[model samples]
Target: MEIDYSQIKVIGFDADDTLWVNETYFRDAEIAFGKLLSEYETINKIDQELFKMEMQNLGIYGYGVKAFMLSMVESAMEISNNNVSIKTIQAILDIGKDMINKPVELLDGVETVLSTLSKKYRLILATKGDLLDQERKLEKSGLTDYFHHIEVLSDKKEKNYSRLLNHLDIKPSEFLMIGNSLKSDVLPLINIKAHAIHVPFHTTWAHEQVTEKETNGKAYKTLSSLKEVLNLIH
Candidate 1:
């Protein structure tokens, strides 16, 4: 289980559930959304449809609350046969506004981990989703000073990481990524011959879930807490 960090020069971190509370808000929003459409469909059905709607609209709307807002609106229309009241539509928009306005809640040991890690290795924040929202959260989180570079990616596939590393003049061997989602943060780096660490959050979006077979032989470290990272990195 021993891995080398001696050659690692830059560390890329996924900003969502890894650093702050994110998926939980989305989960709460889904419950709110289900209630908004409760008269039209059951909560379980509404939840499934909303996820499907999001998957269908991901390419066009991208990620973040704005995208989820659109999906909710679309799903409402389809679920309600376009008869959703204007008042209900207004509530849906308000839901997104509330999400955007919510204060950033940093995870335990986040500041300490970043503060300690940034001393030696270069630290970069590489999160996926809307740039504006990510920027807003970073500003609110008061952790902006920790990063040398901050990027909001449309997606987090291997190609995206490759392009980012190349742009930063970082060889894959010298870069490491740390995050909650295996699909977005860990496997992509592993595939590209970079190191990654998995720090699982309590709630993961369905899209971020990966099969056991996909991770069966992946070379990455998993820690119970963000604080645990300090033990290995130094």
Candidate 2:
């Protein structure tokens, strides 16, 4: 079906893994964390425990490296029976810092796509993460000027996107969201009767994975890369 986007007045973009490299760092952190506690548990166990910790702390920490850092600390404490060395704990903190300080490596065609789309429609960044961290990354990304508004959301759900529509003074049909996560970026918008485009990243977080049944009959387009969006919208 040709989903008409001529009525779309606003386009919401997810930041991490969509605009720049994100999950890769978290994956790297996990690997580093596993090595730190190699003596405590197997790598597989550490991975499972760390993910469980992140999920448990999601409500309290929301989403971001800071939260992930805390989860890592807590998991380390538990995995090591609270006997993990201070130096190892310090190493985990350092891993988070290194991730924060890492350069904002923009995805391929991100700038070209954003610059071209910005001239045609109202482009906004609707992402979920630590506000300060997101803001800092935006400042570093050099693509901040391409967006008119930046919303660091607590979560990406129907109500959240609906509030965004109300704030933009647009109906659901007039708003289109694009991102890599089907769970967070696509399904919610589709459920709310809004348009969404899925741009699958190389690696998806386990939390963002959706069952085939969840997307069985949804009306949306999935593109291999953000570059293809221009061809679709144009």
Candidate lDDT scores, in order, read: 0.95, 0.95
Residues 1-234, model 1: lDDT tens digits: 788988999999999999999999999999999999999899999999999999999999999999999999999999999999999999999999999999999999999999999999999999989889999999999999999999999999999999999999999999999999999999999999999999999999999999999999889999999999999998
The worst-scoring run of ten residues by lDDT in candidate 1 lies at 1-10
Per-model root-mean-square deviation over C-alphas: 0.6, 0.7
Compose the digit string of candidate 2's lDDT tens values, residues 54-115: 99999999999999999999999999999999999999999999999999999999999998
Highest lDDT scorer:
1
TM-score of each: 0.99, 0.99
